[model samples]
Target chain A: MNYRIWEGKSGDSLNSENQKCTSRCGMTSSRPGMARRSFLRGTAAGIGGMAAMAAALSPLRELEAGAFNSVEEMLQKHYKEMTPDDMERALARIRRQVEQRYHVRPEIRDIKPVEGVEFAYALNLSRCIGCRKCVHACVAENNQSREPEIQYIRVLEMPRGTLNIEQGNHHYDRPTVPDDKHFYLPVQCHQCANPPCVKVCPVEATWKEPDGIVVVDYDWCIGCRYCEAACPYWARRFNFATPKIPKGALNPNMAYLSNRPRPRGVMEKCHFCLHRTRQGLMPACEEVCPTGARKFGNVLDPRSPVSEILRTKRVFVLKEDAGTLPRFFYYFDERYPRNTGGEAPTWTGPEEFPHG
Target chain B: MGMILAGLSAIMPNLDSSRQNEFDGAQPGLEELAHPHAEPVDPHIPGGALWAMVGFAALAFYFVSQPALPEMPLAATPVVQASEIAPGKRRDPIKEPPRIRVGAFTYGCNECHSLFLSAPERQGPLAQHTHIKLDHGLNARCFNCHDRFDREKLVLRDGSLIGYDQVPTLCSQCHGTTFRDWERGMHGKDLGSWDLSSPRHVRLECHECHDPHAPAYPPIVPLPAPNTMRMGTPVHLAHEHKPEAGNPLAPWWMHVAGGDGAAHGPGDAHEQTTHHTDGKTESAPSTHKEGGGQ
Candidate 1:
């Protein structure tokens, strides 16, 4: 059977499809009978040539070593896709890497959410002192990139009377928090019931877990940056380069889906320390908080502190209009007695952020 | 078809084995599924999701029908973790109560107070404890805290003896609200499991934060400032200067002396009482703008 392949080019007349080929070769056809076999051969050769070139540079990849890790990482499956055997192999690979690089035995696991556990977190805006203890604790806990500085929690010090998060300062270096003329509001991943980040993820790399933690698989993330752009609270962070962490400082405790050492060009966000939380331990921030401002517990359990807080305290979420349905709540105590100057604080309601 | 179905059934012999090899805590029920898909599942109903739903519904019904009130735990256990440096490396000035140490010897109140150390001698001043300044809002007499009879225990107003561990009880006599809040894990630092079933949380003692004698927390060095990548620094913006609106082509030197930032009220460096704003006496805005922020 003789078939002609149409080369769609600019200014070609519609009747050009019937025009006979003027080539000297034995090919006398309208467009050209680009034999399917030849086309297939060309594709195979191109792919093979590329692979051969890549293989020729294998020595360089071996020399770098991390190149191999990157390739292996790129080939790895998402957490949901991995079978038990695959997970075992993945865990072994991770353990080997930690032992080889950090010279420390890490207990990295793919921890699961607990039964009858739906985690809820509430931060007492009145109690947080903007100490950054929770921030550092998170960095240390989650193996966040240190150099370019990826901090999940941003403790913004708002002037005495302002609900403007834009005006909130995360880098306020102070001796103590709850400064007389300022209030601190530390914001991190709200882990919304309907997360825009999860929705916008092109690779399906990130998803909300059973325990209300939104987790990202660094391996599966193509780093298209759609999730980062979609996040309302600026919760997600991307590794622009290979995340540099001092081997000694690398947290031995890690989770494959959350805090494991990520390859360059992957997105990571706070997952509420799934490794610890699954084992009935508190998240790093809650443990290190000097003021008992952060309250986290199973929302399903009515007796849990977080449930009590939600019921008793006048709770509010950031950007309720966005309709992300954030699980994280920010609440203020009834008594904010400390007021500066002659003007009173613009605290209209307990649910309202400090509005000027 | 029968053989294939039987083979599939045969693969599930371990159903009664309580398989614990699931990754993290993910349900083992996923493996039993005839089909596996990579797309996100309804996490609300993971593996064995049907059974879980049934169990939850049953529990809900039981709780709704029961007249006996649900019992709340005394306190949720906070999973204790090392703060600052590791447990071994932390100086931890006061774990609970302040203690006096000289050379290799640690001293109790009895070490000094027994020798002619009656209540009358406190006003006369002593050779030791001179460095101690009782500045905790008026209740500052030596015997107000220290037991007059027993050298080791604290003396409550009603003459009850309280140890260092029970210092909050003694302090609660005056600072009732804070004490109440502290007990409920609101005022002070606490570590542990947020689970209702976890053991009692370890609450930080009153003296862990406050100085017993001074009782006022002195200003300490701040943590390292965050370089929030794209977000930049979190400096309180005095005014948002849109380059197009303001003098975009302002001389580079003007920026050093403060940009046409909000068109200043006469760049008079001397008259700006604006900051002394930062407790310093010298006329600022004349020299340091960035340095003062740190």
Candidate 2:
């Protein structure tokens, strides 16, 4: 394609147009009026030139949505860095977007953690039938994206004789659970005291609250996905596409640091249903469990259900050796927890769990 | 002197004015001086003032004659407590069997036991309640829970009778650990406010989940499973396969992709995951005895 016809030495002639362009650009041009005429002619093309430009840049925009929302999103201040007025504007912006897209006026509030209340969840593994009721309850209560099927809870089925999480199957399904030889262990975000996800976020989008719940500011998340990679439990989920939930299925009850409709290209995980929990109500997952396996309450209160579970039952945390200091605990009975009574029910310890 | 003068002046006016008005309007007589004989005024109260007095009297009479409010059933008792409640406010009753029925009918135990003498032993193989099947864990004996003397009440290890409302007491006789857990709001379902002080909170009794006759949870269906996040595609159940020996931590999608993991869900394979075809199969009593029943 190549002849150097438009090179510095190959100018054809100086024109009046070159003089005008040279004045505007402040470049010493021989044919200054030529450039100025072209600039006006380009303006004359109007949106047609824009169409041509868009077509030319279409390949790059396709790679990443470098369109309208990106520029403002990239300039957004970190959630923690934003002032109260900034937060109000951001929240209002989010509320408008949610209302426009979902046709629901979502109350996107920044719900504060209650003073003197630190929430903890306890699941009775012996009572848990691995029903997956808690899992779906979370999906409905939290505005989870239904298309990619983001669920907060994953009930793993372990072989009879193992506590090895690596050997557990998260996709366990059955008519009735407590599969004679198999037991279930459901995993979600642990809301750790020392969370790697919070530590790894380049932007301070996620952090641990005073109530011990780890939360993420949806607006501040830059979708770097470092948190997802850092978490050992696979707790964080990334939104690959703009999350498409039907307006009908949207849970209008939303909170800023927890389960509001997240923008595309952000990371989200469970926040222990902070919206409901902070309001003196049980979490949706705990309320829906049929076998009464899930228990949640304020840890500070001596009489709370979680306190009782922690005090009396033999409780263990997943990946205890990892030292995440999880607030979620799993307690099991001594094999025959239901029958610790009259007839001397025979059973052994954890070691006797039938190995696959 | 001033007082005497004032009294004499009042007397003089009556004497002088009465005589004057007598000649002005009255027929010329000293007897008519005080009465002014021309004007015949009626000695009655004015109509407007009388009507005002009547209205006031009627209003007072209506208020005085109004009926009193009826008495309430009980006067001002605190609603916060009962001798035996789960731990919170008394709410809608728990989901459980409504108390023991007699024979094949829905009659209460006291209806029949009130007449018959309490039996020391089982009545006979021909007993009416023989239709009943008890397959709870190990503590399966009838006398272990039910009172020998009072058929209507539950018996603790002690010879005392426990009312239906005190079922947790009857249950706590041997299951002390679970009772403690339940008291602290752990073991049982506390369908109430998390703020314990809030009203309408209730901890369901043990019988809500376990049938008294069959305490073991019956095999039932589960809620739907999570599919690919954001896509509404229902995950396909795995055709019969074995679970992979390792790689359990590899995320649910990895297990599903491997095809070996979906084998655990027996319901999904047969008769859509929603329906339970095998739930009715345990009607026969033989298959009930096991847990070795954990």
Off by more than 4 A, model 1: A1-65, A68-76, A97-105, A173-178, A337-356, B1-128, B195-201, B233-294
Candidate 1 lDDT tens digits, B1-294: 334324323433333233433422222122223233333221112235334334544554454445332332112212223345221111144323455799998876676767764644233345666888766655545677777667678788887788777878888988887776566555566556766467845556777767777765543444555643233212222222222112223345544555364333222332211222456543222211221111
Query: What are the candidates' individual DockQ scores?
Result: 0.10, 0.08
Model 1 DockQ class: incorrect
Q: Say what the RMSD of model 1 is.
A: 22.5
A81-126: candidate 2 lDDT, tens digit per residue = 7788877877787787777677899887878889999989898888
Q: How many Å off is the CA of A323 in candidate 1? A: 2.2
Candidate 2 similarity to native, TM-score: 0.63
Query: Largest lDDT belongs to which candidate?
Result: 1
Residue-pair clash count for candidate 1: 12
Q: Model-by-model lDDT, in order?
A: 0.62, 0.61
